[model samples]
Target: MKHILLIPENEKPTLTAAIINTLLVSVLLIALFWISLNQIQMTLDFSFIGTYRIRLIKGFGMTVALGLIGFIISFFIGLLSALGQSCKILAVRYFCNLYVMLIRGTPLIMQIYLFFYILGTAWGIENRFVAGILILSLFEGAYIAEILRAGIQALDPEQMEAARAVGFTRKQTVRFVLLPQLIVLTVPSLTGQFASIIKDSSLLSMIAVIELTQTIREITATNFKLFEGYLFLGFLYLCLTLPITLLSKRLERRFRHEA
Candidate 1:
């Protein structure tokens, strides 16, 4: 008699199994959290949520607006910076390289202080909301630049050679051959970066940007419900980020399948 395997290799889990696992893990986490809270003799009170509902809604809107606007501006900045890095001109290449290095090396909080206090003061950027958006864009742009640069560099050299052999001009080659593939390759990563933008926008609260975090901070300050306020804050952020995270994974799988 031949030995038989019980399951197929690399088989995907059934929907029912996935659902069951999800519920089990969720229940385990909730139980552990409840037990920990009981040990600490602390109970969470979300009663303040109803009172501060309007402010929370406004703050949530501001955060979403900031993230959307920042991502758009930063994407263009990143694209140009990525292209500049590969340019033949030494000055452009060095400038782009230095930008990526400085931004990535330093903490964003420091940059925020430097830009808002010094640069914004000098330039007369009096509006804190505008200043925050610019700061977030510049900070995130460096990271996006590196992502795009990696995507560009990862493209197969043979494709370029093939384009040239087919008498495709540089512009034609880029537009027809390179741009489409680069977009496809980098999109999943870029989507994930948008989620990062949402989380990082919280840091803008330090500058009094009046986004979700700042709103929660102000509420907790008055009500002294720090635990409840922050717990709700985490839930609100999950509402924003979790969907993007799932979409990023789905895109990665779909693209990988296509390839």
Candidate 2:
């Protein structure tokens, strides 16, 4: 014999504070969107269009060049450092760790000022872009090293043992098996590193390198159009960052698919 129990067909759940807060946030965003569109329409003037376009194009190109070169240098430094830290030699590991720690501890902007302004042209290194790249490379190199190390270390110990067992020498294992695999796994981290390099390029403005942020600041100062300048800059930054974000997502998907 079984006892039958009857309950309400649809039980209503009580609204929590979190739910209320989410609704409030949605409403606030809707209102902010409406306000921003009105202001954007009023402020987006293309007066002095040719000059402004030239300034922006030149600045954007410089920014991209700096970021790309820095990414390459940083990636190289990071790989070497990551490998050195993971090396069997005690001296190699210790020195690599020390370098990583020192670089990570310092502020990137300070590094830029030190390299570009203090160590100027007469010191046989006057080019602002060159100094900017070196500093950015060193700054982001520390972080990218950690990412590479993690990606390498994330490989299974069994896989390494299997490589060794299969008559692969240590060097052969690293080159043929470990490095190729690490490069694939490190794609997301490298994308993040690239994005960081791009944003950090803004610090070059302090040394008057005329990157995108510097151009925007200069333009806003003359036009007294701070709001519009910032809005445009935000859009530019988004444009720069969004591709890296998509690439990272795509790489993640590919990795998952391969797995």
Candidate 3:
């Protein structure tokens, strides 16, 4: 014998504060969109946007690839610069410092222009893509060198002392004891630098590298959809950066757990 419980179909669920808040947010967003549309007085034509979808996709890929290649090259440059800065030779240290200072002091666009012109003149390298890689790597290398230097310096001096006590030479100590810890300490900073490099890659479009920003410019020039074009470009960049940011956070957490 089962007692049948009959629920009234006319009963309505009460709206929670969370649901009300979400509704309010949606309404606010709709209002903002209306305001923007009225102010701009332009039709929201996504047809133009779709026209350059392939180019945008290519540019997005190129931007990410360029950033990654630049990051790798800059890391090596930074590592070498860091090692050189810590060298016994005063001349090498001074040269490394000069390189860092020179790059840091100048504008990135100026660096790109100079690299393009000077490298073109001296080495017959006229490819803007190649030039962009070199420029970004060199620009980021200086900053990354400082980051690496700080990471290396942050370590307890006793570690190096213990390594030397165990018959490790100066080079061996750096290779084994110093480098592994340096890598862990510098990961967060390097991740930030990589993000910075991706943003900086947009400037390469000025040199006709046809990356994301260039694609945006090309699209907007066709339909005068400047706002939408830039908004889309910004979204594409966010798409590229957000993943790296999340991954960096995850890596930081994982490393912290391991430590």
Candidate 4:
């Protein structure tokens, strides 16, 4: 007797439901916005966008720059720290573990303040941009270290053994085999972390770093347009993060396909 096989059907996306949800969300947002504005004695005023366009543009540029620089620095730190944690040497592993623990356990804002007030002063670096970038890099490095470590460790053990059996040096094996796969695995996560870094750049504003939030504050301080200023701030953050978020998803799909 022959057996019959059944395959599960894929669920089709419903555009009608999607459209209805989008419309519902739009209506709710509009109603909430109107109510909030009324409570705050504010009306929609997009005039600030035109008036401070150049300033806002500069602020956005600065914020992007901060995130990019910090991410780059953190990437290297994370890679090295991951390598350290994976090293056979117990001292190296312990030190790396301690570093990761110290950074991950603390609040990022506290780290930023400590860097600005304590380390920056000790280093005689009065530049807020440099301080902000350094602090963020340090803060993000711990998380990225764990991400990379997990990716490296999650790789099949046979790959490493095969490389060693072929008389490949550890360094050569990591460079030629491990790193390529690790990078593919970690790309989505790294991109998402970068997006978070962009958002966290707002915290630098508390220290008077002239990023997007700071720019909004400066504009609102003079104009008293709190509602308009904050709305634009949220919009600007979405602009910065949405592209990277989408890119991460795309990269994840591509990696999965390749795998």
Best by TM-score: 1
In the predicted model 3, the residue pairs found to clash are none
Clashing pairs in 2: 121-126
Q: Which runs of model 1 end up more than 4 angstroms from their true locations?
A: 1-9, 164-170
Q: Which pairs clash inside model 4?
A: none
lDDT tens digits, residue span 41-141, model 4 = 77688887998999999999999899999999999899899999978999999999999999999988899888899889999989999888888888899
Best by lDDT: 1
lDDT of 2 by residue, 1-259 (tens): 0111222358533345446656878899968977887876754565643669999999899889989999999988988999899899999999999989988998877777776666665487877777778888888888999999998778778888989999999999989888777877888778977988999988888888899999999998898877668777878888999999899988888887543
Q: Candidate 2 or 3, higher lDDT?
A: 3
Per-candidate TM-scores read: 0.91, 0.79, 0.81, 0.88
In the range 1-259, model 1's lDDT, one tens digit per residue, is 1112122468766666667767978999999999998999998899999999999999999999999999999998899999999999999999999998999999999999999999999999989999999999999999999989989988888988999999999999999889877877898999999999999999999889999999999999999999889989999999999999999999888888543
Q: Rate the local accuracy (lDDT) of all candidates.
A: 0.92, 0.83, 0.86, 0.88
Instruction: Return the lDDT, model 1, position 30.
Output: 95
The weakest ten consecutive residues by lDDT in model 1 span: 1-10
Q: Candidate 4: RMSD over Cα atoms? A: 5.6
Error of 3 at 141 (Å): 0.8
lDDT of 1 at 196: 97
TM-score of 4: 0.88
Q: Residue by residue across 1-259, what tens digits does model 3's lDDT show?
A: 0112222367533445446656878899989987988997866666766777889889888999899999999999998999899999999999999999999999999998888887756998788899889889999999999999998888878888899999999899989988788778889778978988999999998789989899889878978888778878888889888888887887787777533
